[model samples]
Target chain A: MISKFTYGEAELVTQLQHRNNQAFTYLYDNYSKALYGVISQIVPDRESADDILQEVFINIWRKIETYDISKGRLFTWMLNIARNAAIDKIRSKSYRNELKNQALPDDVSMLGDQFVKSKADETGLKKVLGKLKKEQRELIELSYFQGFTQEEISKGLNIPLGTVKTRMRSALLQLRSMIEQ
Target chain B: MNIKEYISSGIVQSYVMGLASKEEQAEFEQLCLEYPELVAARNIFELSLEKRAFEDTPHPPAFLKEQFINYINQNTTTNQSKVIQMEPAIPLAQSGSGLRWLAVASVIFLLVSSWLAYRFYNETITLKAELQHTKEAQANLGTRLKILEDYEKMVINPNVAVVNLTPMPEKSPASANIYWDSTTSNVYLIIKNMPKLPSDKQYQLWALIDGKPKDLGLFDIKDDHKVMLKMTDTRKAEAFAITVEKRGNTSGPDMDQLQMMGKTQL
Candidate 1:
C-alpha cells in the first residue's frame, strides 16, 4: 500500500493538523511498519502489539495539534508515543496476569527466538546494530527500546550512572558512523 | 564554551533519546536557540535514528490499516453529528391553528433562548478570564522553574566563583552573594540582608575592575530572595559593591551611599 501522496515534514504536519484523511492514510502507510517494529520489540505478544499500534495511530491523529516542530522530528514524536503506549500495555494489570498465566520459559524463549529470527532476516540494520559492543548495545536497548531512565539502566545493568550516559553517547555515535558509511 | 565539545558531550544524544533530565533538556533547548550548530548536530543524530527506525522494521499486519481508517471515519462522522446536535432544534407545525400556536411557542422560545444566550455569553467571558489567569500562572511557574534549574546548574558548576558582599563597618549589617561564572562571565546576585529602600530608590551593583567601578546593573530587593537574580555579565572584576542609587540611574555608583562591598578572591 504505497502512498501516491508524498509530503514533506511541514506539509504533512499541516495536512494532518487540518484532519486530511488522505494525508493520514499516507502517514499510516509510510510509518506504520517502523512504529509496529518498536511496539513489537517492547510487546512480544503479537495481538497486543497490534492493538497498541492501532492505539498509537489513533492517538497521533487526535493529538497532532500538540506536536511541536521545534522539539524534534515527526517520526521522533510518533516513536515516543508508540513506545509509551506499548510500555503502558505491558505495565497494565491484565497484561501482567496474561504473562503470568503463559508457560513462562517455553513461550518467552520461543518468542525471543522468533524476534531474533525476524531481525536476522532483515538487512544492514541488524548488522550495523550488531557491530556495537554488547554493553553499548544493551544500553541503547534499555534506554531507547525499553524506555528505561538512565538511573534505571545504571541500577539494572550494574554500571555507574555516569558510564551509562557516556556509553549511550558512544553507542549512538558509533551507530551514526556505521549508518553514514 | 566549545560548541563542538558541548555537542559531543552526550547531552544532545541524551536529548534526542529522551533520556536527559528536565533541567538538562531545558538547558539544551535554550542553547539550541542561540547556537544553530547545535541544532544541526541534533538533526544529524535524529536523522540517523530515523533511518535506523525505518530500515528492517517489520510491517504491521495490512488489515490494521483498514481497521484504522474505518475507526477514523466513524469517529469523524460521530464528531460531525455531535456538532450538529449542539445547534438548536426547530419545531414543525402541522396546521393553521398549530402554526398559530407555534408562533406563541416561537416567541417563548425566542425569549428563553435570548436569556440563555445572555447567560452563556457571560459564562464564556468568565471562563475566558479564568483561562487567561491560569495561563499567566502557568507562565510564571515555567519562568520560576527555569530560574531554579539555572541556579542549580550554576551553583554546581566548578568554574562559578561565589563572592560575598558584606556591608561597610560603619553601616548596618547586610550581606549578599554573587555567583560569577568564570567561563561564561555571567553574574548572578542573591540578597541576604538589606534594609528596604524607598520606592524611588533601588540597589545598583558595581563590578570593580582595575580600580574602576563598572556598572553591573540595578536590582529590586522586593523580588523573591530565594532565587538568584541575574545581573550583567562582566569578564573582569576585582571586587563588587552595591549602592542605593536613584531608580533607573545607570551613572557611576554613589560612593557615599555604598551599602555593601566584597572583594573577589580570584
Candidate 2:
C-alpha cells in the first residue's frame, strides 16, 4: 500500500536537489525516526546517534547529486548512506575516545518503549508486520535489528545458509504481496 | 548458476545479508541489471526488512531531527562560502607571484643591460623559462592542495575509523593512522615519518589478531612524501602492523621482520 504522505520519490528528490527546505522537512518527517532507529542500532548511544543524525543529513545534502533512481529507491539509498555513516561514527577514534569502555547509556533504553508507543499509534504498518509468520519475522528481525550478515544469521539461528536464504526470500515475498494487496 | 537456480538458492538473501561470495556478488550485480523484477524484489525485501526494524525501535528524539536539518543548513552555507571564497584566491596568488617575478626580472635587466647583449639576451631567455616553470609548479601545487582537501573530506565521513599506529620500539621510528570504515568494511593506511623503502621492496600492512597476521595490503612510499593509501576488505582487525615485504605480498606475514605495530583500543 502507498504511504499516506504520497509524493513521487523522483519529484521529492528533485525538490531536495534544488535545496527546497519544505521538501527536506517533509522527507525528514517521514523518515527521521526510522533512520534514527537504524542509527541507534548501529551506534547504540543517544549522544552519538544525535551527532550521526546530523552527519547523515549533511552527507545526504552534499551527495544528493549522486542519487540514481535506476539503482534503487531514495529511501534505500539514503538509508544505506545514513546507516554507513552511523556505523563509521562509532568506529571513529574520536567517538571511541569519548565513549571508551562505556556501556550504552540509560536514554537508549527508552528508545524501545518510545518505538513501541509510536508504532502502536502508526498501526497500519504494525498490522502488516504482525501478519508475518514468527520464523519469517524472526529472520527479518535478526538480520535488520542486529545487523547480522546472512552467515551470522545462519549460525545464530542454527539454520543452514541455504535454508536461511529461502526462508528470508519467502518471508520478503509474502510481505511484498501483503503490502501490495 | 542460472538465474532461476540462483534465486531459488537464496543468493538474494545472501545479497541482502551482504555475505555473498565475490563471484556470487558479481553475478548478482549482473542479474540486477538484467532483471528489473529481481531488482524490485531486492528493494521490496530491503524496505520490508527496514520498515520492520524501524517499527521495532523507538522514534528518535524530535530534537535530533530538528538538529539534523539545522546542521544541513549551516553546513551548506559554510561549504558555499568555502567554495566561493577559496576558489579564486589560489589563482590570484599564482598570477600575483608570477607578476612579482616579472617585476624582479625587469629590475635585473635594468642593472645588467650595459654588460653585454649576449648575456642580456641569454638571461632574458632563462628568466622567461623560469617563469614558465614557476607557473607549472603553481598549477601542480593547486591540484595537490585540492587532493589534500579531498582526503580531509574522506576523514570527515562518519563511517571512517581512524586508528593511529605508533612506531615500534625495536624497529624504525615511523608511525601511521589507519582509517577503517566498518560500514564499507575497508581500511586506509596513512603513514607518517616513514623513510623511503629500497627500490625492490614495499611496506605491507598486517592486521594482527591473537598473535597471527592477516595481510591487509602493501604499498611503496612515493618520493613526494605521499604516505596515505586506502586498503580494502578490512574487517575484524584487532591491531595493525607494518613490515618490509617483497615487492608483492606473501600469503603469510614474516613476524621477525615487523617494522611497526599498534593495538587499536579506541
Candidate 3:
C-alpha cells in the first residue's frame, strides 16, 4: 500500500492488469525501495543502477500478463525482474566499457570495499545476522546479492559445489530463524 | 520427496536467488506443485530474501520510479519501441523530487500557452470581419457625398431655371419643385412636402406639353433631402405636375388626383 493511496495486493494485481496509474503508483510506493536494493546490490554503480531500475519496471509492464498468481506473489515476480535487469545491465557493453576504466580485482576484500559503500543498511543486517559467521554472510551475498550461480560461485571462491550448497543452506536457515524471531 | 528434506536442501534459496539450474528448477517446481508445504517454504524464503534486500534500500533515487512509470506507459501504448533515455541518470535521484516539480510546472505552462494562442486566433478573425464591414460602409458614404456635390454645382449654374410648384387648393401642404436647364433640356423633379402614401400607391411625374399630359415616371416621397432625379427629357415644356397613381403604371395622369402643378418660367 502507498501513503497517498493504497490497495490490497490481490485487488492491485487486477487493477494492474487493467493498466491503471494509481495502482502503479501504489506499486512503486510499496515495493520500490526493496526493488532498488536488489538492483543496486547487483549493478554496484549509481547511473547503471538507475537505468536498470527504469528498465525493470518497463519489463514488468510489458510482461505483466505473463505473471501467474498461482506461481508467485507480485513482489516475487518484480524482484526477479529487478535482479534480471541489474544482471543484464552488468552484462551490457556500456556497463563493461565503464568498468574497463576501473581496476577489476578478484578477491572478497576488493568486492566488499566497492559493495560496502551501498551497504549502509547492511550494518543493520549484521545485527540480525550477528550470530552468523563471515563465510555464511559472504555466501548469501554472492548467491543473492551478486546473483551468482552455485557452480559459478564455487568456481569463484575456489571451493567445491557441495560445500557451496551446504554453506548456502546454513546461512538461509539462520536468516529463516531470525525472521521467525 | 520429504518436504522437510527438500526445504533443507537449499534448493528453495537457489530458486529465490535465480541461481538454480534448469533441471533443479523444474524438479523443485514439480515438488512445490505436489506439496503446499514446499510452496509455503518457498514463500518464506522469498520473504526472508526480500528482508535481506531491505538492507541495501538506498531510496533508489526518486527519478528511478518516475522514469520507470514513464517507460511503462510508453511501452504499453506501443508493443515495441527503440529506446528512451531519461537524462542525467546518475545521482540526479538525490534531487529527483525537485525535477518532478519542474516537470509539473512545464505542463501547466504549456496548457496556458495553448489556450492563449487559441484566443488570439479567434480575436484576429473577428477583427478582420469587422474591418471589412467598416470598409463597405465607407464606400457607400463616399458615393452619396459625390452625388450631393454634383447637385450643388448644378443648382448654382446660370442656365438653370428653378420652378416652384403650387399645391392643390384642397391639399395645400403638398408641394414640389422643378429644376429645368433650358440650354441642356435636363428637367428634374423634386417633391418637397408630400405626405406619406399608401404602399399600393406611388406619385407619378407628368410633363404638361402643349396642353397634353405626358407620363414621366414614378418618384418616392421619402428621402427628399438628396439630389433630384432627372424626369422625362424635353426641349420645351409648358408645365410640370405630379399625381397619385397605382404602384405599377397608367397611360394618362389623373387630373382629379393632382398633388401639385408648376409652370416653366420664360
Give the best candidate by lDDT: 1
- Residue B163 lDDT in candidate 3: 85
Residue-level lDDT of model 3, residues A28-65, one tens digit each, is 77887878777766766788777777767776776677
Q: Which run of 10 residues does model 3 chain A get worst, by summed lDDT? A: A103-112
Clashing pairs in 2: A88-B158, A88-B159, A89-B158, A115-B58
Report lDDT (CA) for all predictions: 0.79, 0.69, 0.73
Please estimate how well model 2 matches the true structure, expressed as its whole-model Cα lDDT: 0.69
Candidate 3 docks at the CAPRI level of acceptable
- Assess chain B of each prediction and give its TM-score: 0.54, 0.43, 0.57
For model 2, how does the per-residue alpha-carbon lDDT over B117-139 read when each residue is reduced to its tens digit? 77878999999999999999999
**lDDT of candidate 3 over B1-266, digit per residue (tens):** 57798787767766765667889888888887899988998888777666675664678788777777776676556534333333343345544677776886899999999999999999999999999999999999998777667567669988888888898788748756888888877776765667878889888888777888877788666754433777546557788888888887666887889988888875
Candidate topping DockQ: 3
> Which docking category, incorrect, acceptable, medium or high, applies to candidate 1?
acceptable
Instruction: Tell the DockQ for candidate 3.
Output: 0.41
